[model samples]
Target: MQPTELMVCTQHAPPIGGAFVVPAPPLPLVPHALKPEILMEAIALLATAVPLALVVALLCATVVCLAAICRAHRTDVVAVVQALPDLALALLRRRRP
Candidate 1:
């Protein structure tokens, strides 16, 4: 039941090679350490994404410019200004029995 008796029964002896093999402590991993394959994968992803991002940006800008042009040149501005009497006549005709 005592610690001494247990140690004696086990008969602890030196390792086979006369030295205990202990694994060296792993080197601490610094942040953002990129392995070759991981770096390559990131590069590939960026290569694919950059052009797509640029295309989307250009499309958005084109759409915005078109919308601005359409808003600035509404249908009301395209036609000649009608006379007041002609406008009243058109309204009268629209409501007559």
Candidate 2:
């Protein structure tokens, strides 16, 4: 083997010194595979969340309306008081020592 044949001169040459450093190219802010999927998943979840929130709001509104309709007329306070449990009445009556 000859020493002249061992020499390689191309753009891909290995650097000679320990102090020599090649500056790295800038990294992308978002990863390649994850970029599109993350945005799509977030939008899908947001779409689902909006409908779920609306259903919950409608259920709360229905309950409030029903309660108002049921309480349109007042009955005797004593009759209402007697219908409650004894423990609840005791708790409401006063603070016990």
Candidate 3:
């Protein structure tokens, strides 16, 4: 084929390896019966509800972690609390060497 003929053939061919592609149909439009105010209210509710739910979940997680830590160190905490009075008395009774 002449170069001019080859160029004319390719000019009408698909860009990708000559594969034919069908154009996608456009999306359907929303019905006129759907109110914009209802959509906006739903969006607003989601905006506030999502963050509020996240904060509550975070707070619940924090409380669970703290409870676990305290449970794990319960004996150590009790021992320190019980020793406070003796430690104070010992400090008061210490004399210069």
Candidate 4:
């Protein structure tokens, strides 16, 4: 092939010492601030959501603590559960007496 033909075939050959102009990418869309009503809605949502989250967190902590206590006294808890029926009967007998 001729040199010019080879140069034309070479995909990456830069224009002979000529500056290449790359167009700048289009600017991204800028986000506008929330309207006052939307901002207040968000605040009100957060106010309710925060307390609900705290309540759920507290319940979860309570469950975890109770589980830990049960685990720590596994045998005792089982014994008490097993004795509940007898204890109820004994309480009934005592009340009658």
lDDT of each: 0.67, 0.69, 0.72, 0.73
Best by lDDT: 4
Considering lDDT, where higher is better, how would the candidates rank from best to worst? 4, 3, 2, 1
Angstrom error at residue 96, model 4? 56
Better of 1 and 3 by lDDT: 3
Comparing candidate 1 with candidate 2, which one achieves the higher TM-score?
1
Top TM-score: which candidate number?
A: 1
Clashing pairs in 1: none
**What TM-score goes with each of the models?**
0.44, 0.41, 0.41, 0.42
What shift in Å separates residue 55 of candidate 3 from its native position after superposition?
Answer: 0.3
Residue 34's lDDT within candidate 3 is: 69
Q: Indicate the TM-score of model 3.
A: 0.41
Better of 3 and 4 by lDDT: 4
Q: Rank the candidates by TM-score, best first.
A: 1, 4, 2, 3
**Which 10 successive residues of model 2 have the least lDDT summed?**
1-10
Q: Give candidate 4 regions above 4 Å deviation.
A: 1-33, 74-97
| lDDT string, candidate 3, 2-74, tens digits | 2343343323445456543345555659754367987888899999999999999999999997787688777
Alpha-carbon lDDT of model 1: 0.67
Error of 3 at 32 (Å): 9.7
